[model samples]
Target: MSGGGTSPDYVFAPHERPLLPGSPATPAHPTSRRFAYFAIGVFVGLTGGFGNAMVTTNLANIQGSLGLYSDQAAWLTAAYLMTNVSMSLLLVKFRQQFGLVTFARIFLPAYVLVTAAHLVAHSYTTALIVRGASGIAASALSTLCLLYIIQAMPAPWRLKGIVLGIGIPQLATPLARLLSSDLLERGQWTVLYVFELGLALISAALVMLLRLPPSERMKAFEPLDFLTFALYAPGVALLCGVLAQGRILWWTEAPWLGYAACAAIVLIAAALLIEHNRANPLLNTRWLASRDILRFALVATSVRILLSEQSYGAIGLLTALGVGNDQLIMLGLVMVLATIAGLAASAITIDPANLGRPIFWSVALIAVGAFIDSHATNLTRPQNMYFSQALIAFAAVFFMGPTLLIGILRALVKGPNHIVSFVALFSITQSIGGLAGTAFLGTFQVMREKFHSHSIVQSLTLADPQVAGRIQSLGGAYGKVLGDPSLRQAEGAALLSQQVTREANVLAFNDIFLLVTVLSLAVLVWIGIRQLRMYITGVNPMSEVLAAMARTRGQ
Candidate 1:
């Protein structure tokens, strides 16, 4: 099982909150007031989601204006994502040591400054630096929102809140895309960040007004084992970097890249083992061994792989087909349907009984839809393209709603420690999965094209009488069009080469779709086997919450 970030569901724990030395300990509020606070957190988190997605969709335009190449332009997105994923764990200790109020107070100002920096960012290097710092604050704030929501809401409502909190980001993509035109029309992507900063200001106001229960607060942190966390950070960074770069750097021969990746993984694993044996570990690995969290991590890994393929792959395919900016906006806009569907699905199904069913079916839809999308090269047929895009959107609704619900349920079952680890591990794995899938698929497309070209060329270079006559005839036609006797041979060769390239491209794309199908099927089989084994053992995975207390004690 993957162990990464804290589970927001752990906020529901009834432990008394500890206060900072000078900070006032706030009394717990009535359920009504607490729910109101939870709502505010959702609003702030959703706002961030909207801004984050807008920045992602607008990356291409940002690169064009800033003069960054494809790989360099990627740093903006990668930096933000990496910071968010890596630093979340750090906040867990800080939130405990400083108190939520104090942490928010610190992050708020930094957030404003970073947002402003992005607005006036002049170079790729500068923008990434600014984004990296801003991302740290954003990550802390988001985790705070999750922690607060879990603390404020009742147990029954906690899972749904987490689901909505997570779902908001997924839903925002389409909405942001729909609004991309108006934002882009205003010149530069600065306008989006301005809106984000405004939202942050609003969140700051809400945070000030709404007081949290002392019971929900964290205890003062002891001195961290920096030696251990230090090991984990670079390890995670390298592992993700290698996966992200492997496809780009040709996998094996990019300087010290491969060696560094191996070393990082080895070091990180060793450190984790060392930390796990320590009295106060960076991660609570003992709690992580519980069946629920471990199984949840496995499921999350699969879901992430699918999500990576869908989001990154879909975006690249759409852009590659020469889709207009307006169309791209509309394409993303369709996700609202899925988000709404997820929300509705959550409302009807709260008990853990039917949760896994939706997850299974949704993943199936994602696999099938993505596989179809891989074969989506008939861009001239608008109907066909829309059909493919719609299927993907619909599948996303199924995939996201169910998977998110299951994750929240798992977090609820596992508690804060496991939740944190799960999220951290989830982020790390999903990032790796997406980068790996895109790179592999991209390289596969290239390789397929080369093979198709060779075979088709060999077929074209005929010593056979019939093939030779056809080639000569094509040369004659080319001579007629150019009316230049000397240039006829070269023109005929160029025409044949163009035709071969086009055919090769189509075949390569088809192979990508076939591979996606195989991936989806493999996921189903894996999940199915696990479920069958659980059934045979007569142990409900969701039932592990009953033993969570036992697991904690053993740890």
Candidate 2:
């Protein structure tokens, strides 16, 4: 179990051991080593997130460059998530069986190779293959980030490292949006991949130069693990495809969507059935089916759905108004700062006795933020969203750490064997939650836009003097360009229709914002009621479970 050299004279605090079995034992470091670890952690974490963030934030531009349609661009994102989510389940065991060194050695080089492929191929099929590889690499890098962060901190502050490791990646989207405009302007999508490739190489180098301390390894994999993964991985991929493409292909319009959904259900169900019968299952279906775990999944998934107000709602609205990423630089800056603030706040205020309170506050802030955004007008720009978007951004990171810890505490309480189950559960809920949220909100916005467009068109009458006056005013703008009055009138009418469509889109986005607000508040109420019930019954579920876990680990 020991490494080649004498192990560092370091010890893990009881609370930290349950996080992962092969986690490096933390030796107290001098200020310089600590600083290096911190820097490496941030770099690794950001690199992991920024890889996908660059593609996702600039999907449209990438699509245009590759001569792809909307749905094709979507497949890139879906392909990434397909492997990213399912890989986490196998990765826990991979780390346990083979150790961090092997995990990184395999994946990091693969990441670089994949990035190189993306740079060279520049084709749709190649892009899909590379993205799937990137997803696996991304999962490894995220784990590496946490490992590095844990090494940086002293035992007393180790938990704070977890908070930062998880929360820092959330900043990538904003960072990507901030930098993508410049990257695209300079050298188009190639510049972006070159940058990612450079980061991949740098991350690999940094990790090699500063290796984590070795830990105990075990023969963690079983035959059934592979069988479960074989069944589960494709099932989740199919579901991810369904969710990602459903809105783009218009749900019922695509026959493939139905078939994919059905296949996903059958595959996942069969996997679960196999696990359900196994004495040593990978997924721990019964524990996951328990009330507390179900509730945790629901709350986690609901928060993800509500968080889409930023991704699908506000961003979509801005795009409709022709506001590009260049114009939203300040907004992205605000989000990054707010996310840092949230990370600090969560770390400082985390309490096992009341882990749910931050979630409450987070949901409240999201609701309030969404409500503020609901009143946006045609003139609304990125500047108009600064405060409200920051609130949501803060809440987004603020809630994640505690939610993760809650599940971790419960999983560790049961036993180390349940760790894989928790990881898989958390990954699926967050990934599928985001996907489903985007699909639902996007579809809803489209439907609302259609309704609003119909209503607005019906209300507009050429006989109305006001409408006539507006048409004349619009026509006057074209007088210098078009000699014929008939052509001018036609141009004016087309412009008016464009205006109406813009208005409808704005109205639809407002409705989406309101829906997010309503859902947030409703979830808040549901959580609050459950918390109150627990209090009245004199039973603190998480506290009791966490305490037992500590005692068991201590023993």
Candidate 3:
């Protein structure tokens, strides 16, 4: 007898069985039990993302509190992602071999212990170790979130549950921002770790209290799996390290960055070469490189990069404008609320027959928001950004569920073995894609800032009366302390230079917004063209695949 109840019908009907090995059984539950499952899903999803989100929002504060340099601080994020991005490749297999209940029990408790270690460990090395451990553990919770939500919803609404489950963690980004000022006030960076520890503890306890239904176990791992991981893990870590530190250290100036990049290429190529010959490969490189999968990967990665408009663009602009976390509380609140609405909207309106539509709308909404933000000036503040940011926030969660569903359905159509490959593709596109977006945009902004700075400085001449007068007015404020006329004039010129630098930064950010706007529109057009082609041809592979899925469930 299965813990979920009787043996699954898949015992007789193989076609309708769990899509992948060791996936949680979906037994019927009472109303109260279902509600409890939903509640746990929300909490665990929040916990999964809170650790990284809190650290990211308060990076500068954490850096100062630890006496770390700018480049050193970037490692904290890089460490988390280094492990986080590649774990999904193995996590599906872990669940397959062990079962979801065991998987949760193991990772959640380890999460608590690692978090506590972080609380006690003050050194940079220990912090990086703990952060990386946290990533491996938290990757499990996203799976937990999905399984719990599946148990909560009726069979018909399970897709909605998937949407909510995937999107719930995204809420943590803005939520962390909203709560950061208060948490830091409670204590320095330690309080943030303390808070994360508390969440991990509660989550661990909650899992022990209510267990997931039993899943059938399998002998999923091979000796070569370990070898593949050894090479692949470090390759990805090095790649993530390079991306995280490139702009901070300036790509060309850092010799190690070049060495790391070359090493990453070799290691990853070797791993894929090994997998390419395996009868049961961990990563299906050939499948991933297929035309349809390639398109999906492109869209997934590009959208994530463009979505950096909110994280690296809007937040960067406000920070440049001298706004602090405390001042931007309301903006964060607006994003949180808008994100909730987006999730709700996506869930309620999901059309399994037309999964691609939300992606189109998401890109369109982002394009519009970025266009609005491209017009910002020195006078712009968080309040000025409320609407555009809200629109982008709404679009952020709005597309996630549908995007995921498209991938999920497509993977299921390919058969059970492909599940690991799909998880890897999806996770990489979401996590690594976000990091790449920030790195690319940050580098673009810096280069543009230099360009604008030079252009603005070039336009200024002392012979221009307005320029000389502005300098005199700025220097006048320093007159009480510096009586020398030459000193006052020099001070005036310095102040003028500061204003020019600030304006140049603002202009550079506007260029980023415009670049994002154009990219978003182009992607939207590409998706639109594909949809148009499908309609005109009256032939669709996706329609056939969806029909197959419906037929399997019906049987």
Q: Candidate 1 residues 421-445, lDDT tens each? A: 5556656545555556666777787
Local distance difference test values of all predictions, in order:
0.63, 0.88, 0.88
Q: Put down candidate 2 lDDT per residue, 1-555, tens digits, no spaces.
A: 232112355454554332556566565668888888889888889889987999988888889999999989999999999999999999988888877777778888887888888888678998999899889989989988988887788877876777778888888899988888888889878899888888889988888888777655777899998999999999999999999999999999999999999999999999999999988889999999999899999999999999999998999999999998789888889988898899999988888777898999999999999999999989999999999999999999999988988998898889878999999999988889999999999999999999999999999998998888888889989999999988987888888999999999999999999999999989999989978898899888877986897788678
Q: How many Å off is the CA of 236 in candidate 1?
A: 1.5
Worst 10 residues of 2 by lDDT: 1-10
- How well does candidate 2 match the true structure, expressed as C-alpha RMSD? 2.1
Better of 1 and 2 by TM-score: 2
The C-alpha stretches of model 2 lying farther than 4 A from their native spots are 1-19
Models, CA RMSD each: 6.1, 2.1, 2.2
In order of appearance, the predictions have TM-scores of: 0.80, 0.96, 0.96
**Relative to the unseen true structure, what is the C-alpha lDDT of residue 401 in candidate 2, on a scale of 0 to 100?**
89
What digit string (tens of lDDT, one per residue) describes model 3 on residues 284-396?
Answer: 88888899889998998999999999999999999998999998899999999999999999999998878788999999999999999999999999999999999999999
